[model samples]
Target: MSFTRCSLFSRQSSSDHSPSLLFTGLRWTFGAIALSLGAIAAVNTIITARTPPMGPRLNGLFGRYPARYGDLAYAIGGEGPPIVLVHSLDPGQSSASWRAVFDLLADDFTVYAFDWQGYGLSDPNPEGLNAREFGAQLRDFIRDIVGTKATVIAHGSAAPLVLEAAESGQINGLILVCPDGSAPDEPRQTERAEFLAQKEISDRLLEFPIIGTAVLNWWRSKPNLEREAHEFALWDKSQVENEARLWHVAAHQKGAQRAQKALLKGRFAAPWRELWKNSSTPALLVWGRHARGFESASEWGALRPDASLQVVENALLMPQLDAPQEFAGFVSEWVKKHTE
Candidate 1:
């Protein structure tokens, strides 16, 4: 009706459409939420897919309190006497750390390789990450799982647990490989304390929410894995190329960051030297000639003359991985001599 044009019939400006703007804003917000949820779902799916299967590998869970993250994953194979191969407490390490020597040892004695709690396929417990607890776990594992007094071969920081088990008469024999300690006169105590302090700080930082994930992703990057493999694990770069993928995958497993955080915080470290000194069990100390720490094997030998010392030539920290045949040979002979 042109007779009197109503105000409602007037042309409205773009600014007048507040309701439309609000609707559009709501749609965008919901879209963003959906996209975020989808991304999270995808990531979870990938993690689930990448998780390794236990398979028919004779792996089993053992511990007294299974519900309290006391379930430990272990693999057993071969025949004859039992020999448990315990891996180091280094970041990203697990039962897989002994893969290079597992089959070789399995050829002779019944070999057991296990992931410490929170590492590899084992359960995680933030509160149970300490040396005494770990030592108890080993003792229980031997008593319950192996069903016999088994010989223990422990590496790096894992040395303490075996040593403690030996002290408690839970194990038949003990072997320490590139253990974490220095000679009495060496000025390593202060250095070790400072290093542990830094590691504790780093571990705490890695426990943060988003930042922890980001930092761990960076820490487990391909380049870093390659560097660690060559500089620390292996003498040859070709060996790194072969094992880097396995290490990378192991480092990315669920709870791996938490495990590494627990270890780096020195939770598994104890008065290991005192334990070693007091241990009555027959022990074999296997050292890599080029290993950085424990340079004074001769000095330690003087203190614990009962323990035998053997240095693997041309090997760094991991003689088992670098020179599996020789390491296995030494182990076989030592086990035979001691077990007899």
Candidate 2:
């Protein structure tokens, strides 16, 4: 999924960029801006939802299949060894998160990307599919439809699933982009402990009514939501669509909300120290320099002889979106080298 800042309102203005003023009033200003932006986005979504569908036909890219979670939808294309791309649980991104890379690679490889249940066009998963459950579905997807061991690529929250799937011998190759739950080199034990504790607290906060409404509103608010939708479509001015915006609105739908809640509760993390200690799949770890997590890509690389890490300068969370051509070139060359 793409990265977009949450908006909130504040009394401060952008003109107050003075270092001293920022030092003294940064917190309040940031909060206010966030609030205002969030409110704007939420209102825009409400209005947009009420209007008729305004974008071009999405075409017949969606396919339906039944899984334990209910009906699931996917879009497949391209022409090489099957590559299954899994977008993260990031709030607003769906298959479009891989749009840039998808278009570029589809010319060379058979690309299969899907909307995870409760996230996009796919049916909701009330039980909230965790990595374990996701891995089971992945096994079925590869063995049944792809018809061969495929290369698995994931961004953000799905890294754990890709890792677990590879370790379990479900796939032959793995790629993790801006993965969450990553630890930095020389990580302070306190940081790790705090992360563990904060995850639970954050989950709970998102579930609370007043705070949750504020958070969701902020997430859906105007310039913020617009930017989020734009980012998912790779910030390309031409690619922006009403459906992308609608997807953002649909994200707050009952089913999607349940999935969001489930995600914050640690449905994606798995203790994998031992698993990494003896894995054989070749992995390529790509992270954005601006991404908060995954600071120690090199350290992770050191853990596995075949794992390589590439840090894309200035890319926030979705490097594929942030630097499409570069990522496409890398993926093209990488798959060629590793896929035999």
Candidate 3:
């Protein structure tokens, strides 16, 4: 009789057993809650990773809307003719790239150093990035802020943009430092075409969301920044630690990747030689002794024979940062000579 009763209890309908049913339901509920919490945590982490806070730095004043590309961050000082300094379009570069030489030039001329759109303290563009759009923004900035024909000093990628503006008669004079264009080896038309094609293919990969973000982040990482600062930007290794910190901070700013991605996709490509060949504006070409790209200063000089050339010894791409005194003296003397 006892064995029969035990067997009957075990065979009873599972649904009729409250304790067992309750335990199963509780297990499922707890699992769902845990998964939900984990999902929320994951989303929060991604958000935090993507949006980094910008630190406090001097950007001077903001030039609003009608200037194009929303707003521009610019600083202006001194009492002489306006000299607008356009910074390179490198991933971690900004107007602050000229910080070492800003005050020096300001003492002699009305110096204007500005962050291009999607850089430094300037507003980022949600639409998209293109050279034409940047040229328009620069034209508007010159018209609205400088309020007169100003001398434009452009570096690296900014060189082509300044050349375009000069072609449109927006600037009185032009100075290019380590401008990007056709490489010396790629001087032939077919070679230039091949270079552009290769660049387009490489740059297109950076437009993908996951891959592009990862690539850009890696490129701007602390280690890479330190190496680049020491090898490419500054002549002295001792200066890299501090500059790398600043560069890392700048690279993490929200929307910083947008400009880089756009640039990588060939949005800034132009016929640099054609622009240089046609520009009648008095120009100065400042090259670092160790600068890359141009194989011969004489070749670049021949492009604009009327333009003056100055080479800063023991410097890499950025003489303004590496040799500020010599760079500023040359620029000051050039400005004085040309503006007169």
Candidate 4:
């Protein structure tokens, strides 16, 4: 009887402790992984910073301009009401996204497109890109560089930055292509705080050094870039055929991971739809005809009855890239209406 009681008690105690032991084991395992990645990330970043970049450095249509985070690479052309083209987010993309339509629009408007810091042709910042800083940069660019209130055409992740930049009041109008979300009129501060908190933890880990950078390089690798292009970015894969190879070069630049790390930390994100809704500035929302599972322009119209929405034919993810002429026409007409 005594032995039986002792055995039963021992079994119960072991069972009770197993779950906590498992959790501790998992925490240690992840900690080891974090350390490994951090070491590798630091080495990679240092090597990149020390050496000159290899093969075909990124170039802008015009040249670099003095901007907040670093010297921003920009291109300006044409002779009418000024328009600024802000590229999609991430280290992989830059003003190059506008190449297809830039010249077309330049015919009528003084079109300007530039690489934000930590991106193509722009100097890399060790601290990485932050959404608010980008917003402030855009604001300054418009005030000092652009020199006038103009139409801002932004795509994908860049849309939110545009909204941020618009807060300072240099914007006469906006065109958001395939914007990320429909923001609520009221700020969802609680949800944002929680989300940011979660990301901050990860961001801290990524800010370490080598391992984090390695992970980012893995993500920005050519294969991954191609995969994203086919799976989500482009509705038509052929458009990527003649694409510039500079992004591959750009991704490996020293401190490239800083931008990726900041992005992962959620520093570059914003409530774009909400910002657009509240801006009271004249605005247009555009979508690719085949924008896979996104809110339809009509659905968006119903949500913001005051706003205008348009759909370009035979495009997805990137309406302006796939259908530049149609996208250009939208810009020309909208600017005409708002400015006239």
Number of backbone-clashing residue pairs for each candidate, in the order shown: 0, 22, 0, 10
TM-score of 4: 0.77
Model 2 / residue 208 / CA error / Å: 6.3
Ranked by lDDT, the better of candidates 1 and 3 is 3
Model 3 poorest 10 in a row by lDDT? 56-65
Tens digits of per-residue lDDT, candidate 1, 6-111, equal 4443444556965666688799999997787576556645654775643222333332324235577778777889999998876667787787788888888988
Question: Once model 4 is optimally superposed onto the true structure by TM-score, how far is the C-alpha of residue 109 displaced, in angstroms?
Answer: 0.8
Q: What TM-score do all the candidates reach, one by one?
A: 0.75, 0.70, 0.78, 0.77
Report the Cα lDDT for candidate 3.
Answer: 0.77
User: So what's the TM-score on candidate 1?
Assistant: 0.75
139 in model 3: Cα distance from truth in Å? 1.1
Stretches > 4 Å off in candidate 2? 1-60, 182-215, 219-247
lDDT of 3 by residue, 167-199 (tens): 667798888998777423445776888877887
lDDT value, residue 102 of candidate 3 = 83
Candidate 4 — which residues are off by over 4 angstroms? 1-61, 126-129, 181-200, 241-246, 296-303
Local accuracy by lDDT, each model: 0.74, 0.68, 0.77, 0.73
